[model samples]
Target: MRWKHPVLGEFSNETLIHMAEQNGLIFEVGHFVLHQALKAANDWLAVCPTFCIAINVSSVQLKNSGFVEQIRDLLALYRFPAHQLELEITESGLIVDEPTASDILNRLHILGVTLSLDDFGTGYASFQYLKKFPFDGIKIDKSFMEQIEHSESDQEIVRSMLHVAKKLNLNVVVEGIESTQQEQFILEQGCDVGQGFLYGKPMPSEVFTLKLESHAQA
Candidate 1:
């Protein structure tokens, strides 16, 4: 979702997405992105059968009654396994029309599609949504990592999140792990999965494929 203008130079993905949302075009944009993502995932799986792709779902898309059916048709079209496609929704996405969101989420769950609550603590009703939604996991927001190594309160907050997630039997993923210290702290706290610059920055599909091939050969 990157865009450049002659006068403005370039716009961030988030800014473009925000503009789309404000213009009431998020549903159309989200659908297109979902389709393209599924196609990309299908292509990637041909190279690495174990690879799984996670896509973010917009609140507008969730509100649409045909959302679940669209996903079903796309998975069938791509011949991709439902379990290999993970749909991530934020707390804010679930807040608008909770019942509708819950129903759609439940159906997706039954269809074997993995669901995750993204940006776990940033929303106002995080815990409430967690209790109501059928999420396979939660991604602790990247903001938590900003000063985690030096801030006791931040560390305690993350520990609390991990503790609650453990009680719910949910997989926990901490985002924005940029250093060995941050990674070690989360690892010591029993978080086994993380995503950040420590691993790699965003790259083109070809670049990622090359890296994968190199790793496989090694």
Candidate 2:
């Protein structure tokens, strides 16, 4: 299988987007792919209704007027609450085109869909942008978890992020928590939510559902 992104030319679109979508994993899907996925989700809801899925929203999608319309139409068709769907945009996406990003995110907030800032520290915008935009949560990048024990800078950054989120009253989710120590630290920090391989890898609908059911029962 050719695993290149057909659009960007730099990356295999297949490995980048298609494989994730086909497997029902929560990864980046551009405007075109997201529209199709919404349609599929609507169809899936009829039979399997337990999974709450998230999709990445790129900067280009935000600037387009049709994006919000697409979301509204899909919600009407699927009849799922906005909370069940998450729209993730990279922190860099916010700064690349500020005005458009602000407008688009505001509209999405009005629509009641969850907005998450992915890869929090990788972007140029500082903590100021966090206050400027209406984000529901922030995802701390996995890179921070590296050498956390001896690296005062890394630890301080994480602590600062946690402090900022707490003051802002926004949710914090630490991603890429691959080790037990990382998991324990996040929990100790009183982070509201988390996602990492330490908990479970992304799986198909059936497997995801089973895991959720198990957790509820436990």
Best by TM-score: 1
Query: Best by lDDT, which number?
Result: 1
Candidate 1 lDDT (Cα, whole model)? 0.88
**Model 2 pairs whose backbones collide:** 4-12, 4-13, 5-11, 5-12, 5-13
**C-alpha TM-score for every candidate:** 0.93, 0.77
The lDDT per prediction is 0.88, 0.72
What lDDT tens digits, residue by residue, belong to model 2 across residues 81-183? 7776788788656766889889888988999988888888766775767789898888888889877766889888898999998998887888888788877
lDDT of 1 by residue, 1-218 (tens): 45678999877666776787899998788878778888888888877888888888887777888999999999999999999999989877888888899999999999999999999999888888888889989999999999998999999999999999999999898999999999999999999999999998767667877888777668
Tell me the TM-score of model 2.
0.77
What C-alpha lDDT does candidate 2 achieve relative to the native structure? Answer: 0.72
C-alpha lDDT of residue 1 in model 1: 43
